[model samples]
Target: MAYCGNIRQEGCGKLERREKYRLFLYVLLIGSITALFICWMILIWEKIPGAIHIRAGIRQDLDLNVPVSGKLYKAPAETEDGAIPVTGMNAAVDAREAKTLSVDLAEPLTLYAEDIETYTMDLKLFGLIPFKTVNVQVINDKTLIPAGIPIGIYVKTEGILVIATGDFTGDDGQAKEPVGHLLKEGDYILKVNGREVEGKAAFMRQIEESNGEELVLTILREDQEFDLKVRPERNQDGEYKLGIWIRDNAQGVGTLTYLDENNSFGALGHGINDMDTATLMNLKNGSLYTTEIVSITKGENGTPGELTGVIDYKESNKMGTIEANTVEGIFGELNESAASHITTQAMPIGLKQEVDLGPAQILCSVGGAPQLYDVKITSVHLDHDNINRGIELQITDKTLLETTGGIVQGMSGSPIIQDGKLIGAVTHVLVQDPTRGFGIFIENMLIQ
Candidate 1:
């Protein structure tokens, strides 16, 4: 009986030891998972920025405000032997001692002036581990007159653009597709029969004079030039047709964003796209003219409004010449006649980082004269994929809401001001909520 009791006691002791070993393994696994999760959170909280833009002549501090402790070291090429003073928290003994840190911008930014455009820097985690390389852009700040008055824009394309292709009836009363698969939308008709076609009128004249003869066409598609042979089809009305729709120029009305010290102005927060093809118009030569708003179509849910204006194309009404029609906006120098109208004082521009979510104002000309209206910036994306949508805002001013039904077509280039600084310009209005709209950063427009 004693021996049996000893065996039972020994088996129970063994079982207890085995249970404790299993518990130890479980605890070890749980501890590892928790450690990994904590590390991931730390990394995310200290997410490094891709780039930072600083004004050349400002005494500001670089406030990344990241959670993890780090030291910002300027790149070697940017400094003398890369021995610039370190700006950050002291090295932490452990992860538990980590804390947020910032760099003193006065030293680095002051070194940049008219000569240096940009440089790079390295951020070290815990003052040890390499975190990321950040691009530092140095820009000169400018005071601009935020002009919200309407202007007439006229832009001619580099070549006759083929907006679409269609089938036409020949003189024999049979359907003909002379441009079948030979030309597509967005194609530029550069020349006809080895002669350069200057404008839409000249191109159409060539087509009409083709007399149903096979014409050798030089086309420019996606930067590649090629030749195609197409015969004109005579319609039932005896007019020769190329079975394609083409456009050479576009005209519209938009609000002016600002006028720089050089009298150069930017307008149309977005590019001028073709009505049918929806492609950016390849600008050849264009002009900006004076216009007067004739009517306003108030915006509604899912339906965008517009501002109709009377554009006098006379030389006396020419405001400026359009030098560029870019995706960012249109840029050109305002003539003396137009620049003389800027009676308002210039305001400093606000960088993307300086923009905050709060009360803001927009300068617009809905009532014939430019005026300031209240607004609210709901969101600001510091590093957004779409540069034009970095700032999202809503119309809060009752006066603007009643006048334009919250943001209409011609209000796109209206300047958004916050804290007495020009921060951005209205770019697009939400189709579902006309009261809300997106804006492009003023820094983006200045770069362009």
Candidate 2:
């Protein structure tokens, strides 16, 4: 009986030992998973921006919202003088530990150079672990005269633009699609039967003279040129036509943004898209004319209004010659005589990084004369894909909101000033909310 009792006791002890061992294995597995999860979170938290830019003679504070303490050190850069640290930007300390890194770039109180200079710095977490390496760019500031006066823009397309292809009633009293798949909207007809087309009038004459003959049409679509064969159809009125609508030129009225010391100017804040195709017009040549505001149309929800202006297309009313039409705006040289008549004061331009989210002013000519109106910058998106929409603003001036019912169509390119500096220009107004709009940074226009 004693031996049996001993055997039972041994079995019970072995079972107890096995259970404890299983519990130990479970605890070990749980601890390993928790440690890995914490490490992953730390890595995600450390993904901070790697570079920053600042203009010379301006003070800015940069904050890196890392939870732990970190220190900044001057990183060596390879320049013409070899690996060295640039002292142009002054900071409080070369190395210091802090919970949330904030860099106060207040040194070099004056303009440093006429060109852009780059510097580098290194950030370390807890003065030990690697953080981020930052590249600091300091550029020379520029000054420009913000010109908000109204102007008329006219541009001749590179070639005869095809607006649309349609079927026409033929002389046989039947519908005829002469164009077929030969051409489409937004395509530019460069040549007809080996002859370069100059204007719509010349193109119409060529088609009429074809007399139902198959003609070779050279088409330009999206930077590619191709040839197509099509025969003109005779309408019931005995008129020969290609069954296509075409345009050769476009015109509109818009505000001028700025004038540089050299009389160079940028206007319209955005490109002129075709009304039918909505594509950027290919510019062959264009001109700017002086405009007289005749009347105003108040904007309402879901419908944008415009400024009615009378532009005399005469040599005496020529303001400038437009050289390029781009997504940023139109660039050209102001007529010397017209430049002398501008009475606006030149102000220093503010870089995109310097723009703040607060009160600002926009110079626009609602009446016959240009005037400054109050606005508020609601948002600023740095590194935006659409450069023209870097800043979003809301009209706050009661007089402006009452006069035009917010930003109108012709108000584009109105200069947006903040802190007495030229920051940006109005580019687009929200159709759903005319009181709000988007702007392009002045630096973008200047770079173009």
Candidate 3:
């Protein structure tokens, strides 16, 4: 009896030991799964991309176009207005019997911007889209503008001067010979004919006194002083002509677009163009001034827009004139003050190649009000030929799109950032679709 009891005890002990071992195995299995899940999550977090950050400046370019208004005419419904006009007969009908048939003209057609006279339309029938085509009578309205008024501002200067002389005829119908010596192109005329001239009037008087005589002129060419003798020719009006254009040193102020926090300073993201030649104007020197936004003129359906402001020269200080404008934008060295908070820490200059379709943001001071808003990087196009117009961006920020109608006139050069990297700078906005725009990659801007 004692032996049988001991066997039972041992058997029970063995069963308990087996149960404990099974429980330990189950716990080990669960722990391994949990650890594996945590490892996977850590890998994903590391793989997620980072954002590119950049300091960008704003630039405003003026676009002028005539604004015209028109009305909309809807197609006649089956139970409503007059019959629609149609050409050609039905296929089942005979060719000879094919006459004009009524058809609906539901689709809209547009009229040119110059054709419309006044804005009068039924909002119920036409909706908000501008009219493309409308009937109008052309009128010779002299009251629209004064008889002999100038349209654009004439830019005058008093800097470096260049004078040239050529054969010109006089009022007496005599062929004047090319008697004057040529003033080299790089000659910088200082005082004309030994008279210290300040403005255009004083120089003109000197030319008048010469009156077809060989006149001695002082000039600075290639930093060396020299004198050139040239004879003036008499025009039909008896005015002495030297056929030279002169310019005075220009001093003005403009807005600063951005500062390269990593590099210290940056300015306009694009080049300023010469109004006469419509080419990028080369700058000898210019000062950066602070500007206060007085007002903003919004862009309409078909009309271009502009930003009007006065330069605060007294309150502003000269940063520097633009040294060069590479494919990225504009670059200049700092001679005076560096941006206060600029740092030398190497920040990410985000390449467009790294951008992904996700949420992002843009910083801009529109209408003199600075604001930040939510936006989305809709689609990214890689390996594109034109990198300036490279990445396709959409304005997902509701408030931004509402106020500025996506991207406005002065918003160019706004920085586009995603995952803490500076991807690109805003270049242009699509007219028909305002939400869409082109951005030049930050890499391209950093080339120069």
Write candidate 2's Cα lDDT for 1-448 as tens digits. 9999999999999999999999999999999999996796465333333344556665544443343333333234423432222333333333343211233222231212223555555555544555556555666668899999999989999989999999989999999999887788999998988888989999999999887899999999999999999999899999999899999999999999999999999998888889999998998899999998889899999998789889999999999999999999999999998898789999998867678999999998977779999999998765566778889999999999888989999999999999989999999999999999999988878666
RMSD of 2: 9.1
How many Å off is the CA of 83 in candidate 2?
Answer: 7.5
lDDT of 1 by residue, 1-448 (tens): 9999999999999999999999999999999999997797465433344666677656444454453333344444454432222233332223342222244322222222333355555555554666556766777778999999989999999889999998978788999888899999999988888988899999999889888899999998888999999998889899999899999999999999999889999997888889998988888999999889989999999999888989989999999999998888999899988999977789999977788889999998875789999999998776666767889999999988998889898888999999999999999999888899999998888777
Clashing pairs in 1: none
Those runs of model 2 whose alpha carbons end farther than 4 Å from true positions after fitting are 1-139
Measured by TM-score, the strongest candidate is 1
TM-score of candidate 3 against the unseen true structure: 0.46
- Shift of residue 71 alpha carbon in model 3, Å: 62
> How do all models score by TM-score?
0.79, 0.75, 0.46
Give the whole-model CA lDDT for all candidates, comma-separated: 0.81, 0.80, 0.47
lDDT of 2: 0.80
Stretches of candidate 3 off by over 4 Å are: 1-258, 261-263, 319-321, 333-338, 341-347, 375-387
